[model samples]
Target: MSPILLTVNAGKSAAVARTDAPSGLTGIDKRPVDGEVAVSAPGPRGVGGSGLAGDSIADLRHHGGDDQAVYTYAREDLDHWAAELGHPLENGVFGENLTTEGIDVNDTRVGERWRVGDELLLEATSPRIPCATFADWIGERRWVKRFAEAARPGAYFRVLRPGTIRAGDRIEVVHRPTHEVSVAFAFRAQLGERSLRPRVLAAGPALHSELYRNATAWAENA
Candidate 1:
């Protein structure tokens, strides 16, 4: 299958009664939009939020930044989860800004570059670490544990060149880093695989800053 941007999702902040969101509101309910959505580096975490203009990021401390300006998930992974959970999973249901097809998002190497449509250039940076907000939103027992064990956290991207993206945009892998550290590998390393920490660190400056710091500490202390 040809890789494509299947949908662009943006969310509005809304109250969710039982969520772990500190503000009692969450932006996990992203919905697909037909129109173009602006994409850019969102400055920094806790200060800058979602890169998508219309997207709402409730937990600024955890969600958005230049390194994680955009969250992407593969439709194939979603289908896997849907089948495992015995429920239909729709595009954007995982709170990802971009729903992609024909791309192995988890296997995408850190520092890989993807050209969306024509102008938007995105660099793969990190993997989404499931949290309480995500677990609460999903409402599945031990959802976090399950998701982590599966090691298919999808991929986060930093906007290298700001532009507009829309549903049905073609996605082309413009570059792939020489390193073997992929999003899934980094995710597993972060989840306590001490042996993989060195490999994850080898991805160098392309890695998310926090992950780099943790890997550095782990290597030093090991």
Candidate 2:
């Protein structure tokens, strides 16, 4: 895998278009190929425009973030997006903030870690469940919900350190913690009865504070 493929988007216009008000078929691949994706820092379009500025978004976690945003590939579905929009991924349909080459975003479980450039450290946090915003883009209210049921979720991050991310940057796997609990596992656990929740509770407070908060709750409930 190529490690990372950082991309910058064109602001809300691009974001909403993909998720809600799609522009119909545009390119040859079939789906919405490309519109905009944003860098952690602003781009030529600027922060409000689409790009981030001077590590501003990274700085949002000066204290710590409960979740981080990361994307991965699920080519089959992507092909649907491509085919529907007549734009291929090669055409940049996702407007993904970053299009990773090496790692599958879905594979990024909570507690996972990676190194970007020299300074910033990216770690998987809670998986991003579908939201209304996503539904707005796809034009189907259930698409977001369906995504959660189908793919489970994508990794979000809590920045361990802040720095710039660029296209083709080397994303090094620094660590993958040994744990019985992962975000997806947790959600699956929630599907029926109490199974993995107890395990998460048992892990104790050694994990990131954010996780521990959920763990603490699960422990109590379990």
Candidate 3:
């Protein structure tokens, strides 16, 4: 697996990001790591927090999964964006604590689970799509909408048991779901796939409740 950069932040600029913070990512393996995270996410920009409230990574990541990590990404994903879009997706590209390689993060489904170590169980909960904040940061609105259209939506896993996660941990997909709820399908439903909403909602409450809440609301109004 390709080695990716790792970073940790006790607090950020609250305005900027780097510059006035201690880079916890470097001392990870006791080496001057290659790719330092491009940015750091704490309270709002976290994977689950919705950028609204809370201070912990757990508060940020959806389903209240792990406290220390809110978002994670593959170093390759960052490289791909940098090469294609002329900008790199650094600092755990979606606010993930553990940036990995060789793991199919986008191919996960709600209720799906994986075992990372002796006690860590990461389960696929929901898709973490672009939000308004992402648009503001990237300086484009289409990536968010386009991402929803492209369908390779990234999954958010709830940490079942606590365990120490390092930079080079191999995250294997132990349980794959039998559903076909791709990002495209999610967008399709968000656009008009009303019929399938209820079923998707029924499968995983923790995963789909947000979307499920909307689905039911739409269903009642319809």
Maximum-lDDT candidate: 1
- Look at candidate 3 and tell me the lDDT of residue 129: 58
TM-score of 1: 0.97
lDDT of 3: 0.46
Model 1 bad stretches (over 4 Å): 18-20
Expressed as tens digits, the lDDT of each residue in 150-206 for candidate 2 is 654545555566565554567788987777556566555444346676676543443
Report the lDDT tens digits of candidate 1 across residue range 86-134.
9999999999999999999999999999999989999999999998888
Q: Where does candidate 3 clash, by residue pair? A: 38-91, 48-60, 48-61, 48-62, 49-60, 71-95, 71-96, 71-97, 72-96, 151-184
Error of 2 at 117 (Å): 2.9
- Please give the lDDT score at residue 38 for candidate 1: 89
Of candidate 2, the 10-residue stretch with the lowest lDDT total is: 24-33
lDDT per prediction?
0.92, 0.47, 0.46
**Candidate 3, superposed: residue stretches over 4 Å from native:** 1-13, 16-69, 182-184, 191-196, 206-208, 215-222
Model 3: per-residue Cα lDDT over 134-157, one tens digit each = 444456547777656555445555
